[model samples]
Target: MPFLTSPVLPEGTLSRRPQPDIPAAAGLLLRPWRPEDAPAVHAAFQDPVLHQWHVRSSESEEEAAGWIEGWRSEWARECDAQWAVVHADTGELRGRAALREIRLRDGVAEVAYWTVARARGQGVARHATDALVRWAFQEIGFNRLELMHATANEASCRVATKTGFAVEGTRRRALLHPDGWHDMHLHARLRGD
Candidate 1:
């Protein structure tokens, strides 16, 4: 493709800087996933609700460690950013949040998150998501961010709405879950919004 505009944020813009722990809300934070958190990651995957949506099992602490290592690598490569949602003081893992499908030239990415069974009703996902959106847009210069989930995921829809990601539309047969193809809702937020 012929060149038009430069990348909105240059390569290494994110990777070169140390990823700081972002305070999500009272008693919560978004921090880089650590190898030591592998056990918690594995445990969270055991939750049927989380596993149902993710459709992947950690299987063992070793596999969970691999996943955390990969997340670290993605941050270093500026390909994607993933964080562990945890207690600020205790460092207990509560969930996860990520900016996936990154497009540096377009200044866009998709948001993804899941919470532990014990943390589901405690606002972990919502607070973590709100903090991540602020960092992605205000601090990191993403022009827009998208949140997508199966139409049946009402909890996710609520989080999206509360975070100001307006419903753009629904995509037909967009994702394959264990139950087969699912229509997905595409929600988005612009920097100015």
Candidate 2:
């Protein structure tokens, strides 16, 4: 079958190239997740805040390792991109940043991130998000990116706004958390923004 329009990005646009290590402000680097980071991944999920927002926890190191492998597989298939936000000098895992739900034909993806407790006040999430926002538009050829957070997640809303994602309004009860459904705030940025 023939299509009426060309894909916004070719299918292999991401998988054909190496996932670059993105540099961010505040001495952070967004690097690809590695198998060795399983322990840290497990530890991070243990944080109450992370657990609450993600609605899932790593039950064991093996489970965390599987998660890491899953991320790698996604990258290879160009389905999603996940990065470990780490300290540039010490290489400590500070957080995670990702482009989830990528649609090459539409040139869109949803941006996501989380900062560990140790990195909360130091602007890790903002820096990582800014870096990803730039990379997605400038380098990867995405036309639009969406960032959504539970209406109750104020910090995430701030990061989205600071990074230039304008609020598009709320998605009532879009995300379900441990406590119940949450009204989600949907924010978006265009490549031209």
Candidate 3:
């Protein structure tokens, strides 16, 4: 079928929360954020890496709880889906992986992720990202998925590459940070890729 003739998602298909639990590779699990995870979530956001790259952090447990609550509303609106990356054996919160900027009509979305301090260098982000990308392409029928990170975030760049995203190009001064504007590396993968 031609591009324009390709069928898009049915109406109401993305207007509610999706199945909350998804199993991932390397004994990782992706599930919706829970209220009880506030403490861990707050602690994870305290990592300086999150502050340096993400430019935002939850200062307190209450703030983290609010962040967790916001994910449910975002799911209801179909704008994003955020999952808690957890260890299967210990059930510990390892990180987060999300598909944001979901445009059902265009079959495109953006993937983003962050790892807890203790989970760094453990392939937590890469495994969770790969699993989410696969689910987005196969289950959600997204044609294209994007992963953009500050050019200085070498670790995230590696995760994107490992998850089969190709570095398409750089968007200069595309992201604002606490320090200043930073160039962003744009990576993407298609369903056929």
Error of 3 at 90 (Å): 2.0
lDDT of 1: 0.91
**Model 3, which residues run further than 4 Å from truth?**
1-7
Clashes of 3: 0
**Clash list (residue pairs), candidate 3:** none
Per lDDT, the best of the predicted structures is 2
Residues 1-193, candidate 2: write the lDDT tens digits.
Answer: 9999999998898999898899999899999999999999999988999977787888999999999999988988888999999999999999999999999999999999988888887889999999999999999899999999998888888899999999999999898888999999999999998
Off by over 4 Å in 1: none
Task: Give the Cα error of residue 192 in candidate 1, in Å.
Answer: 1.3
Better structure of 2 and 3 per lDDT? 2
Better of 1 and 3 by TM-score: 1
Native-referenced Cα lDDT, model 3: 0.88
As a whole number from 0 to 100, the lDDT of residue 184 in candidate 3 is 99
Residue lDDT tens for model 3, 120-169: 99999989998898888887788899999999999999999999999999
